[model samples]
Target chain A: MLLLITRTFKESIRSILRNGWLSVSTISILVMSLYIISVFFVFTSTANEMLKEIKNKANISVYFKADAEEGVILAAKTEVEKMNEVKSVEYISKEVALENFKRTNANEPVILESLKEIGGNPLLAALVVRANNPTDYQTIDENITKATFSEEVSRVNYNKNKELINKLNSVIETIQKIGISLGLLFAAISLLITFNAVRITIYTHKQEIEIMRLVGASNMFIRLPFIFEGIIYGIVSSVVSVLLLFISLKFIASYVSLTIPTVSLMNFYLANFGTILGYQILLGSFFGVIGGLMAMRKYLKV
Target chain B: MINEENIQEEKNKIMIKFDNVSKTYKGDFMALEEINLDIAEGEFISVVGQSGSGKSTLLKLIYAEEAATVGEVYFDGNPLSVVRKKNLSAHRREIGTVFQDFKLLPRKTVYENVAYALEVSGAPDEEIAENVPQILDIVGLTTKAKKYPHQLSGGEQQKVAIARALVHTPMIIVADEPTGNLDPIASLEIVRLLIRINELGTTVVLASHDKDIVDKANKRVLVLENGRIIADYPQGKYKIS
Candidate 1:
């Protein structure tokens, strides 16, 4: 059994080497398809990360009266945190809020001057509430307004950003829908292309397959070498594609980080290196092997 | 009534038996008709016929490549039709077949081509290493072991085919117009090689329309004319022409 396997592998290597250009072309097609898939994964993952960040930033801050006590604001924070729709509520003291305002306007000399002229902190305490679902912000806002101590709350900013938040939610939904559709489309296209390439490669060896069967080779014995050949193609193409993906990701990461500084495409790829490699190998081998088997089905009848 | 003992006795002498076997192709074309023949062990039989005269069809039956439309073919008392589909390879492994096309794997070297037969039979590497070289030497292809089929002459290619067929030491070697693509000298070489193999206790079935080669074989000849056996001559020359 060991000898048979070793010989079959050796024969597969020899066949690949013998049909040099054909093997190269087939491997090239595999690499292209694998690369496209890898790139799609990267794109979708980055897009998902960006959408998550946007959703997290879409929280509503409730400003309280200037004289509202810290105890009242903290109680409000706890109450909002207990809401099923609310993810979390943060209590911002007047001092902390003033400090944040200063930092945010530090780049403008006029705003810094106005802040210094104002002397004491005039900013109101606030409760920042984030919801699990973007649409849940309205319910949280209405609940806060109807609370027994609603008079202590000077204003809720949910109404101010409602249109913007709704638009952001729609944008995220569209991106997710498009990502899924494109991913599926790319997958189908890549599979068809890879399968066609494999069929053509197997067609060239149809006569050799017939000759093998004629020599009294068992079906497994004849099929093993071709299967091994496909696996070799998968292994080689995957390695090549990984290398290409690494080089290309470096360029894409730098360009993308300029627009969305938090997203490092290369970092994402490295962090998921094992997973990406696993997927590439799985897809490459699946396509290579299944394609070869389907093409050889008609010829193996001999 | 024929008893089991009598059938066993006949099987001990005859390697292959055709009992009124007739093969019909699609569209009602009869390729062979009511053929009754028995080939004893170690017999060198040359089947001679014109084009479309059922020479190839007769050879195809022995290899179980085709089933008879009527009657039966028995290899060692086991009917070919009775062999399960999965056991067909096991049956073929016992009989070596050579085609006129050579059917040599184009990418494989002469050594690999011959070794492939042993490889497919699941022979150990050590046995393949020992047997393949010996067979190549017998076929006078020892020095050309590294050459591919296209790199060799027609005779050398056929010799490679024979080497492959003989590598497994099968009981029978069936050559269907093996010399059809070779010149007279090459054709004669193949005939002599088959004769030598038969002398070593292997049955050989050579099918050809080449009168000179068939006459020179001077073995038991079965002549067919339009799917019917016209003559069966012991130690006969080609008499159809």
Candidate 2:
């Protein structure tokens, strides 16, 4: 058994070396496909991280009536915090809201003069509500609108920011869908290309395969060498793609950071190094073996 | 009704038997018909026929490469159709088959081509090391072992094929038009090698159309015309006339 396996391995290596161009072209296709998959991985992961950050910043502010008591507003804030969908609720007093407005627009002298012309702070005290999940924001909004303090609530900021929120949600969802479909499409195409390449390689060896059968080689014996050849292609292409991804990510890291400071491609790749490599190897091997098996099917009938 | 002992005795005497064997392709074309023959152990037999006369088909039957369409082929009293698919390789290993085209792996060296037969059977390293050189020497291609198929002459390549076939030390060697692609000198060399192998107690079956080689073989010959045996000669020539 050991002898058979060793001989098969040696034969596989010799075949790869013998058909130098075929082997090289197959490996190149595998690398390109795997690299695309890895890039998609990095792209989707970065998009997911960005989406999480955006969700964290997204919150609904509920302003109280001008004449509403502070005690009632505080109680409402506590009530909103108790909802399952709500993460936390922060109370912003009218005075603090005005101060924040003034400080943020400090560069505008006319705004300052207009603010001074007003007799008193006209801002409403409000409770800013955060949700655990972006999808839960709608539920939290509904709950707040139907709360006991609904009469005391002047208006919910959710209605005002509804368009922006809906647009953001759809954009993120569209990206996720496109990413998944593109990944699948590329995977299918890569498998087909690899299958054809392997089929051609085996086609050239059709006579040799017949000779092997005539010499009394079992089906498994004939299959093992081709399978090993496929596996070698997978391994080599995976290593090349991972190295390509690593080096390219490293090269583009600083430049990407300058444009989108929030995204550090190198850090993302390094952090998921094992996952990236594992995916490439697993996918590459799957494609290689399946391709080889499908190609060898008709010829092995002899 | 034969007893077990008698059956075993019969198996020990006959190497191959065709019991009313017939082969037809695509239901209409009759390649062989109602042929009954037996080859004993250690015998050298040549099958001679014109093109499409079922010479190659007869060789294919012995190796179980093609099934007799309407009859049974027995190797040592074991019907080939009854042998399970998994055991087909084991049966085939007992018979070495050489083709007209040499059928050598072009990318492999002569040594690798010969050793591949033993390697596929999972022979140990020491056995391969011991047997491959001896077989190459027998085929008279020891120095050319490192050469590729394309690097050698047609005769040398056929010799490599024979070496590969012999490496397993099979009980029978089937050469189907083995000299078809070689010149007369090279063809004579292959015929001599087959004769030497038959003398070593391996049953030799040669299927050929070359009149000179077939006449020179002087072995038991089965002549076929239109898929039926027309003549069976002990020490036969290529043509009766």
Candidate 3:
């Protein structure tokens, strides 16, 4: 068995080296596709990270009516924090709200003067409620508005930003959908091209395969060399593509930072290098092996 | 009455048998028709015919490359039809095949080409090491073992193929127009080599259209025409009109 394996391995290596240009072209296609896939992975993950940050900022501010007691507002905060959908709730006293207004309008002298004219902390104490997910905000809002202390509440501010947040959520979903579709489309095209490349290689070796069959080589013995070729193509292409992807990320990272400063593509790829390498190898092998098997099926009849 | 034990004894003596074998291809074209023949162990037979006369088809049947469409082909006391597809390789290893195209792997050296047969059979390193050089020496190709197919003459390449065929020490050697690509002198040399191998106790089935080679073979000859055997002569001289 060891001898068979050794001989099969040697035979496959000879075939790959013998068909020099064919091997190059096939590996080149694999490398290009894997690079595209890795690039897509980096960009999509960056986009998702940005969207998550945006979603984290989506929260509802619930203001208590003037003359509402501080104890009541604190109670409301504690109650909101206990809700299943609410991640956290912060209690802002009337004095803090007044201070915040003053600090925010400091750039506008006119607004600061108006705030001084009204004086004596006319602002309402509030509970800022954050939900676990963007979609959970609506439920949290409805529960708070219908609570027993509904009479003490001035208003729930979630309805004002509902449209904007919903729109953002939909946009995130749309980008995800399109990213997945395009990724699959690209993968399919790559597989088809690789399949044809392997088919061409097999066509060139058609006579040799026929001779192998004629000489009483077992079907496994004959088929194994092509399988090994596929695996070799996969491993080699994946390594090359990883290197190319790294170079590309390094080349484009600074420019991408200029336009979209939040994302560092190179850092993102390097941070997940092992995972990305694993994925590239898996995809390359999928393309190489499945393509080779499908292409050589007709010729392996003997 | 022919008893079962007596029939088994008879089958063991014959290396190959065709019982009412008929082969038809697509479009209802008959390639071999109602063929009945038996070849004993260590016999050398020449199957001579023009193109499309079922000579190749007959050789194909012997090697189990193609099955008899309407009858049975027995190789060494076992029906080829009963051989499972997975076991076909094992069956073929017992019968080495040589093609007119030589079918030598272009990238492989003459030594590698011969050793490939043993390699495919998963022969041990010691056995391959021992047998390949011995077979090359027998084929007079020991000096040219390092040369690739393109570097060798037509005769030398065929000799390598024969060396490959002999590496298995197979019971039967099936050559289909093996000298088709060779010059007259090369063809004669190939015939002479096949004869020498036959003398070493291997059954040889040579399919050829060349009259001079067939006449020189001077062995049992079966002349085929349009998928039927037109003449069968013991010690035939290729006397086809």
> Model 3 residue B97 lDDT?
91
Give the Å error, residue B62, model 2.
1.1
Could you tell me the lDDT of residue A277 within candidate 3?
92
List where candidate 3 sits over 4 angstroms from the true fold: A65-67, A78-85, A92-125, A136-139, A142-146, A154-171, A255-264, B1-12, B183-185
Clashes of 3: 0
What does candidate 2's lDDT look like per residue over A1-302, in tens digits?
A: 77678888887898789889888988998898888778767866776776676677888999999999999999998899899988888999999999999999999999999988986988999999988876787888888889999999999887344455567667767767777787788778767766776677677778767777787777777788778877888888999999999988888878989987887888889898998888888888888888888877855575
Clashing pairs in 3: none
**Local accuracy of candidate 3 as per-residue lDDT tens digits, B163-210:** 998888899999999999999999999999999999999999999999
DockQ category of candidate 3: medium
Task: Chain A only: list TM-scores of all candidates.
Answer: 0.83, 0.78, 0.79
| lDDT (Cα, 0-100) at A159 in candidate 1 | 39
**What C-alpha lDDT do the candidate models reach, one value each?**
0.84, 0.86, 0.85
Which lDDT tens digits does candidate 3 get at residues A162-191? 666667567667766776776677677766
The DockQ-derived docking category for candidate 1 is medium
TM-score of 1: 0.84
Query: Which residue runs does candidate 2 get wrong by more than 4 Å?
Result: A63-78, A81-84, A90-126, A132-146, A151-165, A247-260, B1-12, B82-84, B106-109, B143-157, B181-189, B211-216, B234-241
Better of 1 and 2 by DockQ: 2
